[model samples]
Target: MAFFGFKDIDKLSEVDMAIYRYIVDHDEQVPYMRVRDLATGAHASNSSVMRFIHKIGYSSFPEFKVSFQTENQDLKNSNDDILTMFTRDAFPNDIEKTIKLVAHLMLDADNIIFIGMGASGAIAEYASRQAASLGFNCYAMKDPYYPLVQQLHNTSNNVLVTLSVSGKTIELVEMLNNFVNSADTVLTSITGNIESPIARIGRYALSYNVEETRIHKYYDLTSQVPAVYLVDGLLKELHNQDVARRIN
Candidate 1:
């Protein structure tokens, strides 16, 4: 059961638990079943099945199935190359688009604010300093007060860049939601969980697909490599644009 140990089964709703139990019990059959079929087997609603998939940290059912297969195959093959895993899992298409978007936003915004906590906060700080070196007026806000002050002053010409592995950090999500509801600030997020609440709130969301397992759950092995890749890419693009503008 790949999904088993990645998520706390006890925390799931009764309907979601039913769906999860059905999937685990019928792991071999689940990959072939339709959403409705799974719902029927679990005695849960179609919506419950969908929600269960997202709740278990997958953007979609197909993605969930693919991750399950990939993880199982990797285990059998004993694939242990971390760099190869990062390269294989990173979403190149989304990465390019996200870099372009970040560059464009930075060019037009009066100020840029990077926000995060924990490991992501450190990444945010590094990204902010990098952006500053590129001549953008940017700063990282690990504390809540600075962002709140910025929000109080002016938000229309500001961009908020948030980083989180789970995309479900309660504090970050609440703050982002407040900004979205109250002002015209541009919001962007870098996260591994594409379907998470903070990811959904961001006007521009960039995601990297890292398969979670029991090891990651206990060890907190979420990598900042993807986020660093994004920031570094964005910086390069911004520099190129600057050079192009000067030449023009």
Candidate 2:
């Protein structure tokens, strides 16, 4: 379910994540495939595939396949109520802590940039408006190609909040990669898959687990409600902290 609940998900390179996602998404076909076949399917070199396999704690390809199959055997398909997918306890332990920490980052930030593509872009826009209403300098970049310098504040801390259901969206990932090394910018990501590439790169990563669904195999119908909740949660926490500081 989570790359077999792998402990070193944070260590996976982007290429390794591609292979991991490919295998998970095409679970039925992977157990029978050779290393070369997996490389072809995941659009990576055989060496990359092997690296990922070993990273997940397998000594050999066959051993990895056997473990993967055992882990996936209990996976069952089910339709989930999008509304109830997130509950009070939905936040994982790490995310619960990150939410508290990120609130401080937002409170101190000179700029808060919300980035996303497609459906997530809509949510990013919504979050920006909400954050702006709280008097934070926030901008939503719906288009991945938008020049960040247009609204960037170079004099102070900048927080980049990325929203994605599948954290593997190429455009968003590439954009994050460009800013990953900036000392003035802080990276935060809200994704359905906490182990996704974007999540791994974020200084703060929050995740809400939900079954990924698609219509016509092209349109991702993954629920954005959890993402909305996380945005509101972060904003609410930020508000509380700001109010407390004012009162103090």
Candidate 3:
């Protein structure tokens, strides 16, 4: 429930960032951290802390505390962990841990082959660039048919991040069936509904808990928007990993 190391919040100046971090870490304590209380704890004038809060996009300490707590209200298992951001949840503390694994696998792979189909193939390409900037070699397997085989043959030190929202792509399922499991590692980002065949094939499936399937007027899969959040979580984990490596 605490801030995810406040990466976005840290972009602000040091003083403003400190206050955001404090509110995030001690939201429950803030019902008590009044102007007088902040003055004592931060050893800065109440005016200074109040000013810092607004600079970082909060109206006042009380309002900020309320917003923080509300955002983090459901502390335990959300029925749909994929729909809810699990790292922000309290149940599986391993959400961040899993994300870190994904980022690390992407970063450390000598030759990473990402297998994805349909819209997820675009997601794979975008993720490839994100990892490349971090100094990892990534190749997004473009076509669901042949490109995957070619890409796989090119790289043995591979991490296959196969993405399927339905987890029922026939070719993807078949590929998962015939492909010799790579010795390196395999990660999946799929809506792990129990009946999903793709979920059954994946080594480690990153569950994207999409809430409901509705016939939108445009017929678009709006639920997949949460895939962006999964990518964001993965990037945060990578950033944390980079910070830890530098600190060590």
Candidate 4:
């Protein structure tokens, strides 16, 4: 299941395991079922159901249900179908607002630092190269242990953009933590889960809220397309701002 991996499953207690199995068995009915319903079906209490949801990285039952429904829908549709739905229905006003705001920050900042690990790292690299092509001083930091913050002398002039699908990567979180007390630095994040740790640290956060997918319990197969779209939007916004400035 997309909800929990083998590592997460091994950490579950007996009661939690029962709840997990119940969820897997009743996957179709889960999105429609209430917490009490799941508790009853799993022979566990409502609190146990809530705890299971938290253990699986979701903050609430509704969040878990929404993610579950999205995952199910994704499985039922082809890649083309998913793309059609996204293009037709996605990109609400809040995302546009965040994009505009981040674009302003990018345009004002003297430097942009894009950081991520693994798949997100690749996305960060793409963003850095794209921004650099447009004449923005940008760097992509894929190395988790790189002393990124220490190398910067002027935090106020730097916009730190972090890309993460989970928003819970230890290295990325640690990197953000270093900047948490530095109010002068503008921290921006694009993540799949907005309520995640890295999201909380960001001064501005944009979440696509897509269903996360993984393979072999370790390889993250979660689509980065949403994040990429956000980056593209940000870059385009930056370009528009530059054009308007030149015109003025």
Candidate 5:
């Protein structure tokens, strides 16, 4: 049977194919099962199960589970209206809490560093400039001089805002890993995939569930819209809070 877009399943060894068939047939239970349990259920070895996962292009079982769950949910809700999907499903209630948290982090931080790669880099620059205009010490780090600036800056009170549509951008993930492992900095991520590596590593992760489409491969048209909305909402809330504090 065809799995996702891979159609070469028939060529797998008997044990590996058994494991694949078990996973394909028992999609709901697969997520909950450990590697050993899955191996037992498939009458295959644990190594075989792991090998199958690798052959399917996943780095780990958890990552595979995330992709599997997403794909399954998408298939079930394939007919939902696109507008509703973005406005309702993508922008959930937790977004407000996330925005509030981000605003608070920005307020408490001594310096804010916004980082992104490719299209997200533009968003980072825009957000950094906007925050700076609001009297915050912020900089958008996209230049090749980022390493030098980071080395020179005091990172203890720094808040790093990373934007990535995929959340798996190598540069962002590497930066986050370094920041989190070495410094006393706050790491925040805005991304489309919540289960992505960068999001998982972040102290505060705000994600939007944009429906993945074929158009995304050729052009990232709508992925950044929700992120922009989140930033706008956070800025407005911060402004409102400041006005209320002054009034009080």
Candidate 6:
């Protein structure tokens, strides 16, 4: 039921709802069932069915099947038994603050790098592309295996923008715990926990306000989109600043 609240959400359509239900209902059976069987049984077409699975959180139908069957194999577990807090209305303040801090960081930084994994990784990639387009020294590292701690320990100049909805990503935490208080390096974190290891260690922290819906594991973004919104706003702010400097 982790993805339940999202089932009938305006954000997701009927087919999406059906697909999620099917996954949950046949949690054990899905891993052995063929896509053709799922499509036929679910009364959905195979192509669209496959796409929907990926959209919900699976990389492919096979992965989705394995994840479904292996729910018992999860390493980390959630504490909240009943969903709460994050919904589509997680508040706008978190995102808004992200915009302001990011712009300021860019104006002050020699370079910027955004790092993340999972949905946060997607966000980092989005921000990196935007920053690069604006001519900022921004990169979103795909090397999740390498400890960001070692990288931060060796690098100089600029800023590091990291994303973690839970604010508990291990590699990222390593980086923050290692560097945060030692040198006055700039770090901006977008996460759910204001007091998480990474956020606590950051020079500036932006928490994505998430509302826990009845059935979804992810919190609603009233707090999260701010990181993305901040990237857009920072670009605009820099544009205005450049124009003003030229006029002056």
Candidate 1 differs from the real structure by a C-alpha RMSD in angstroms, to one decimal, of 18.4
Residue-wise lDDT of candidate 2 within 78-115, one digit each (tens)?
32442466676666867667788999999989989899
Candidate 2 stretches greater than 4 Å from native: 1-83, 149-155
lDDT of 1 by residue, 113-158 (tens): 8899888899999989998988888889887545565554654678
Clashing pairs in 2: none
Q: Name the regions of candidate 1 deviating beyond 4 angstroms.
A: 1-82, 145-152, 213-219
Top-down TM-score ranking: 4, 2, 1, 5, 3, 6
- lDDT per residue (tens digit) for residues 40-61 in model 5: 9999888998898888788888
Clash counts for all predictions: 0, 0, 2, 0, 0, 11
List candidate 3 stretches off by more than 4 Å. Answer: 1-93, 184-187, 192-195, 212-220
Alpha-carbon local distance difference test for all models: 0.79, 0.86, 0.63, 0.86, 0.78, 0.67
Tens-digit lDDT string for candidate 3 (48-145): 78787676567767786666566556553344465544334422446566676667765566776666776778787887788677766776775766
lDDT of 2 at 173: 88
Q: What TM-score goes with each of the models?
A: 0.61, 0.64, 0.54, 0.65, 0.60, 0.53
Off by over 4 Å in 6: 1-98, 147-155, 182-184, 213-226
Give the per-residue lDDT digits (tens) of candidate 6, residues 31-79: 7899998887778899878878766666777776665655633422453
Residue pairs with colliding backbones in model 3 are 82-209, 83-209
TM-score of 4: 0.65
Compare candidates 5 and 6 on TM-score and give the better one.
Answer: 5
Question: Which candidate number would show the highest TM-score if scored against the true structure?
Answer: 4
Taking all chains together, the TM-score of candidate 1 against the true structure is: 0.61
**lDDT for model 3:** 0.63
For model 2, where is the 10-residue window of minimal lDDT?
Answer: 74-83
Model 4, backbone clash pairs (residues 3+ apart or across chains), number: 0
